[model samples]
Target: MISTLTATHIQKSYSFEGIEQTVLSDINLTFTQGQLYAITGSSGSGKSTLLHLLGGVDTPTAGKILFNAVDINAMRQTERTMLRTKNIGFVFQFHYLIRELSVIENVALNAQISGINSTEAYDKASQLLDHVGLRQEKLKYPHQLSGGQQERVAVVRALINSPTFILADEPTGNLDAHNAQALMDLLLDCHKQWGPGIIIATHDAAISSRMTHVLNIKDGVIL
Candidate 1:
């Protein structure tokens, strides 16, 4: 199978105290379908930066990112947005769900945005929520659910679009050990069933070891 995501000679930098500080330097990586990858680094190690670049949330200062051999850096903003909506799904350390919406509503929002009819989207969302084991919590608001339940809802939302790749940054960071393990298992199960490229940025060593492949990032370089 073809690589779902690739970053070639990527470099990123930002201004700090009026001076440019480099985060990543000459980084190169590729991820194929059905692979679960872990990217780990210290607080300022640029792991999240790399994830953002791969997800098209941020652009690299140098080098190119390709999704299925199409240069993402070259695409116009609108084109990139469309591609992201269709191909990439994201989960974060915090479950960024709408507080006002119920779990099912939050999950269905993405499908609805993708032009899926309301009834179809709701049906798909309900099924996904059930798959994530949040069916009973579907009517609950964000705050009404526990941390684990909210995170499950977030995963459902991410998967609702049936994206080709899933990018997660510290997805289980806020959970306890048991909850974290459960979340990891759920993520892996989804990857196994759908075969989307799953790339996660995390600081937990225990979780890192569970990945199929692991990349260590230090001073913005993969080690």
Candidate 2:
């Protein structure tokens, strides 16, 4: 079956002091496995907020988010977290690798959290590291690697669970031109191999131009 992540008329609002601030308004979208989607918008355009909602990181003030037709928003926090760990991968703007763990450990940690055998997780992590040319650095700590390498490790960590969807927020924001392109190339390579639904939030037009399924958000609405 084709797995899907659907957002239905989602609305998100925050009450600061006495006023209400809406970040996303009546958003509706469905993301299918094995496709890539690029969400492009300027700063404070609600791109990140929309991603957070879709990833089940936050509850929508109105409407519901369904994963495989079940309302995830209604699920308990624990259940939602479990669902996210097992089915959704996330690559953030900064590489959040544990400062103390070695490269392989960082990548395999996710799979281990999902209850995979340690040996199996490590083996898979090794192979993925090798694929991304990080095998030599597997035993090294995060601070020992370059910025691009750290981000690549983060990507592998996200893919460790073989999640059906990947939500990347400004993943390339910190890299230079060369490293940024290399990182994008690496992500596409992973996408081609793993066939996950890759949704990236980026302000770079050049990157967004590469995706066939592009979404532009403006003023909390899809344009």
Candidate 3:
């Protein structure tokens, strides 16, 4: 399997009161295509921070992230920005939908931002909404939907770009047990269908067990 993502000697830190707080240290890992991988750890375990660095959403204090063997962290800011927009999709604990947009509209927003026409974006959005079992709620605003339904919409939105990788941070953190399972199933379904490599930061053991491989992050390194 070809590697979709590669990281080596990754170190991230922030200065607080003239002291360096290292969130990650000497981390190395690779994620290949068609695999779902989970990073499980406690709340302050740097899992989310690692995910951000993997996706090029944040720069690491040191080391490199490679997508298709190209070093993302070494790229110019403009290049990395384009790479992120074109190659990666992200989801989070909260579904940050625009309050004014309906479900379908929210999904279409990603396509629109990527320069797709409104009609075509809407068509693809409709298929995704239907796939997520939310076709009936297409016209409803995010505020009008339940938490799980809104999360489904968020997932649909994440998949609209047809990205090469999907990075999710605590995706089920805000859901009830039933809803969390449903959301996890939906994510795996999409992962299978889309064939994008998945790197999820999750605390749930059940969710970790469902993935292809599990990496436990403890004290800034994967163990």
lDDT of each: 0.85, 0.87, 0.85
The residue pairs found clashing in candidate 1 are none
Candidate 3 lDDT tens digits, 163-213 = 778888887777788878877887777777778888889988888989989
Any runs in candidate 1 off by more than 4 Å, and if so which?
A: none
Candidate of highest TM-score: 1
Taking all chains together, each candidate's TM-score versus the true structure is: 0.90, 0.89, 0.88
lDDT of 3 at 78: 88
Better of 1 and 2 by TM-score: 1
Ranking by lDDT: 2, 1, 3
Worst 10 residues of 2 by lDDT: 174-183
Q: On residues 1-223, what C-alpha lDDT tens digit does candidate 1 reach at each position? A: 5456999999999988899999999998888877889998888799888988998989899999999899997999988987777788888667789988988889888888888999999999998777667768889899999887877787778777878898988888777888788778878887777788899899998888998899999877899
**Per-residue lDDT tens digits of candidate 2, residues 62-153?**
98889999999888888888888888998866768999999999988889999999999999999988876787999999999998788888
- Model 3 RMSD vs true structure: 2.2
Predicted model with the maximum lDDT: 2
Q: Predictions ranked by TM-score, top down?
A: 1, 2, 3
Residue 73 local lDDT, model 2: 81
